[model samples]
Target: MQRSLLLRCSNSIFRPPPNSHRLRPPSLKRQSAPIAASSGAQLPLTFSQNYRTAPNRLHCSVSESQWKQDREMATADEQQDPRIARISSAIRVIPDFPKPGIMFQDITTLLLDTKAFKDTIDLFVERYRDKNISVVAGVEARGFIFGPPIALAIGAKFVPMRKPNKLPGEVISEEYSLEYGTDKMEMHVGAVEAGEHALVIDDLIATGGTLCAAVKLLERVGVHVVECACVIELLGLKGRERLGDRPLFVLVNST
Candidate 1:
């Protein structure tokens, strides 16, 4: 049954019901608010507030009015961008997942859509392809999914920041705090050298702990982190603030 549902969803990737486009929430828009990065520059990218209700509820505490004004600011051009709508619609939101009161932004559905998955990598590649990035570091697990394609597309070497005991080599580690306890991320020794610029890629950002640890690990090895990028950002959690000055760039914002 689960497999059939996924297959149906995948098959309908490019076909939407008549006037379905009109029902899509506000299109993507560039954020006026600056997200600080290593260069102290602002990224001109889309930022939208996504609010989902019952059937596929979002466990967000914030009210919708607070973000309604921002949604209204979306430009006509942004609203017309097919990639934004396609990508946004492909994501599957699961309520009470992994525990109660949690809204998980599942990208497995998005991955099943060939065009959507390619667009995901294309967007990141278009942003970093000419930025002189030498290394692309991906956090364990999900990061392993989105990182390699972007790394390969941008002509950069892929570095995996793994969980403890996963890397079979001399490694360096950084311990980070989690909601329940603490965890550590390890990187192979000498994988990156001084004077190299890196971009950290992950699937999503909630509290930003994992990305922070990845940044710290790379910086500890004298690598200059260019910025951190993710496919989704849970605005309600304010994970962006946890990264300090390292800038964060994301494709979709959810609450």
Candidate 2:
């Protein structure tokens, strides 16, 4: 019975319902507010938020083409945030492990680096702390690594979304597709109360089927899914597109 449900869900992946919105990658909007560090915090010397070019300054005068070139260079430089670079560097990539031609983004390397792992959780905690999230629902396995810390830091309940039959009592499950087959994810029947706001956490999103199933399961139980968060995103697969209207946040994007 579970297998049949998963098969049906897998079929729906190819045929998205009409009127679904195309999911675009999240954009970082530059804030006009001046960047300021916390009290006693030392800012990175290489980058300065106070740096500005004025028309009156001798070095500020440039032709239109040069100005455009400078702007492009600045944009490129902005993409390499020091924190993100550290996090990305710690991830180990293994090629063709499960199969040929697949480059896996392994977070175990990040986990090994104590500083990097704490930073990973700290980043998520800082983002969600002020969002009033009542529950942090973590996807099975990898999500467990990141979820509890964030839940504890943000003062929210941690709910584990598990595989079929993993939960002891009555459970609600959602079937989703994988590259080879379909699988079902389950959550305890009373893990979350109706109208509670939740955030879903996962290590990465490849095709987004697991995250989608998670959202469906939570919503089915009347919990409001505020957003989905992941540590990394595989860009070429375009998994973000599969999640319609659901906001996704990730620390790193890799090919």
Candidate 3:
């Protein structure tokens, strides 16, 4: 069975780059989780226990008038997510990114907030606590932010999917098209074993070209890519459609 996830994207990665070289920060120290599970299907999240307050026309929690005002925040996940509002505010969207008029969903805002940063990593661990995830593959380079820590939490190895000609080894490569042009991503052939279950991650999904390429690279090695996890998702671009059959998941989404 496919597992359902509620996402609250952290906005630290979307910050306007001060320097291209310093795009990603250091690896996070592993933290202990208050959970015990080996697979996602085995983990059962109780909705009643997760929601703090009931939704209704009440002043104490949320009033009908207030809900009307916050209509932009009416997605299924946002409505029930305990961390939606906080994470949304943490994500600072810039007016133009890579070009003009493109409001990029940045993760740097969430990275700066210690509370949001840790919560994002910790939350990922909880959701996949039960999945017998053998490896956590982070796409260069933003995926490195949360992927390593989550891997440590679940006792998994951290792997990298880097651009072509970067990894100095016997690499297996796959070519694909990006939003701008053609591109390629490669992984070390020895990095993953045949039949291993891999969880691919990235900071965000826009056109999904890069992710599709990474999935293809993993499949060539006979690795079973159980799912893909990303922090933010820009909807209406058909990003999810690019990833067929693979479980594409996001913490926060903006259409």
Candidate 4:
């Protein structure tokens, strides 16, 4: 029964109904404890367990209606933002990209549209501007694209959280789980100082593993991560839940 429910949830996320641009919320609720595996079954490792073990985490209890209303208000706000439409339309979806059973949200197309790309950065800048954000920590690769511009616009330093030995100086690293193994994200030791306000930037949030790792990396150095911002969010994955009390801001929800 559990397997069936998991399969159904996956299907609902990746296989939306025809003519549907928005995804309906999945029916499966999140389990508090890890599900027990059947005999001889090997369960995949997840980052949620590790995230929960961290100290001083803030937990909130929000009612379902309140959560829905908050989401609705956010959506309405996006609708009012002129950049939202252009950013959403410029993104291209490629089926079975990088692997089968994946519907990849491609942002390269958005990069090609100069106006849309600028609008994307401008939207982020508007939010962080005058918020006293001093450090913009961008996760590797795609984060590199959006982070620099926002950092420059907001008069903040751009810190790169890279993979493995990408950085030349002394660095600190945080590792997170993958399907078959684990991966690490590293940051320069002195790139940011204690008590500095930070904002984490990434292109997308699926299972939240990368963003979670980024947060942990920043926090280790005593940086206060104001919030995480992504270009697109896969709503069915419930990545927001993995972030605990850290708020997430996104321009598009590809449910």
Candidate 5:
């Protein structure tokens, strides 16, 4: 059978092997103990039991499964979180922010509200509960505001992917373009361990160029980009299209 096309275009192209499929053990949900292989078969005296084993993944597998299960629970949509709803409603449309004919969704009003700020982080934490995110990489300025606490709540390491010389160390940089201007984002090589799964977090996505650069930087340091989550998506900027198959999770779609 073909890979789930929805999943392909949604999250980055990750099609697990058939054996790795998440399946409910077909039996009864009862106790957790040893049982005979069959009704008539005798249980082995010294059973060679490894309940949940996935090489190089003893830790990763457990974390990933648990997180996914958390996500499977009813998602906390914007309506459910009154704070999120309030924040969404309070987005003041500023005409010509930074340029002509650009009405930016001003988050300053939302940020000042304590409830709204907390809800925004909570929503993001819940949305990615099942992705076994090893690290949360937030961009400079506003990104730092929401990223750290989310990492602490989810038990993931927080790495700051900064702008230009903001990071004080030997860094890996990637230059990308945006609708209004171009800029470069950088990350320290030692921020995250190689092969760690990283979730990129940001306040908004208008062009997606910065986030893309962060992803590339994480890759350069050997981290697999697992997902990208945003607080708000700008109108008509189809940053999602530019992201292709990467997992892009967001709380608000302004468009």
Candidate 6:
């Protein structure tokens, strides 16, 4: 059988292997363990377990109909938060453009729907508005879109982590390995003050090279990275494991 595609593209970004044909179930042995969000609400153990086992994953077998039902249920729960459903629906997927057999999650479609796009920003804004974050560091160039809006809403400064030589100022850079090759990300020196709390933003997390590089750059400068936030997480790639102990939050989990 031909492999399925999973594309992660926004300006310059990473892509996961094109083989996420099914959504894997979490292990059945553990008793319920609650994972708390910033709102003090408990998230399900399945979501918690999946989030905790980043860079590594657990898969289980189930009938096709049952898997379909599970996905439908997950979608229904996301719709309970109207904004999430809107955002997910607005994203478009393109196949075989950058290369054959690649399924790309295209945010450009989401950007076209003004209401959906605004709601996406509003949802993040509402969540982090009171989190006391001082700097919102966005990875170029999609993060450029999502970060500034959230920063402005929350009264925090927006910092851009750019590609090598993209920033003209005295900048610090970190080199990270990608599935294709190595890439370097740079941040302007003094853009953030020491001991400030920061939140890292990106459009997607695939193998997590870019997000990991962004976090490393921030920590090397003495900035505390409170969390990493993305619009989508390609769960099959297990990017979360590469991020160490920092909590990861996403609006959509695409398997």
Best by TM-score: 4
* lDDT tens digits by residue: candidate 2, 145-164: 99999999999999999998
Better by TM-score, candidate 6 or 5 = 6
Tell me which residue pairs clash in candidate 6: 7-103, 54-241, 55-238, 55-241
Please list the residue runs of candidate 1 whose C-alpha ends up more than 4 Å from where it truly belongs after superposition.
1-77
Error of 3 at 240 (Å): 0.3
lDDT of 3 at 10: 24
| lDDT for each candidate structure | 0.66, 0.64, 0.62, 0.68, 0.59, 0.68
Ranking by TM-score: 4, 6, 1, 3, 2, 5
Model 6, range 88-122, lDDT digits (tens) per residue? 76765543335533446668878888998998888
- lDDT (C-alpha) at residue 120 in model 6: 81
The per-prediction tally of clashing pairs is: 2, 0, 18, 0, 4, 4
Q: After TM-score superposition, what is the CA distance of residue 164 in candidate 6 from its true location, in Å?
A: 0.4
TM-score of each: 0.72, 0.69, 0.70, 0.74, 0.66, 0.72
Q: Candidate 3's residue-wise lDDT over 177-206, tens digit each?
A: 643456678888799998999889998776
Once model 2 is optimally superposed onto the true structure by TM-score, how far is the C-alpha of residue 233 displaced, in angstroms? Answer: 0.2
Better of 2 and 6 by TM-score: 6
* Local lDDT at 112 for model 6: 85
RMSD of 3: 15.9
What TM-score does structure 6 among the candidates reach?
0.72
lDDT for 216 (candidate 5): 80
**Global Cα lDDT for candidate 5:** 0.59
Residue 206 displacement in candidate 6 (angstroms)? 0.8
Q: Global CA lDDT of candidate 6, please?
A: 0.68
What is the Cα-based lDDT of residue 105 in candidate 4? 66
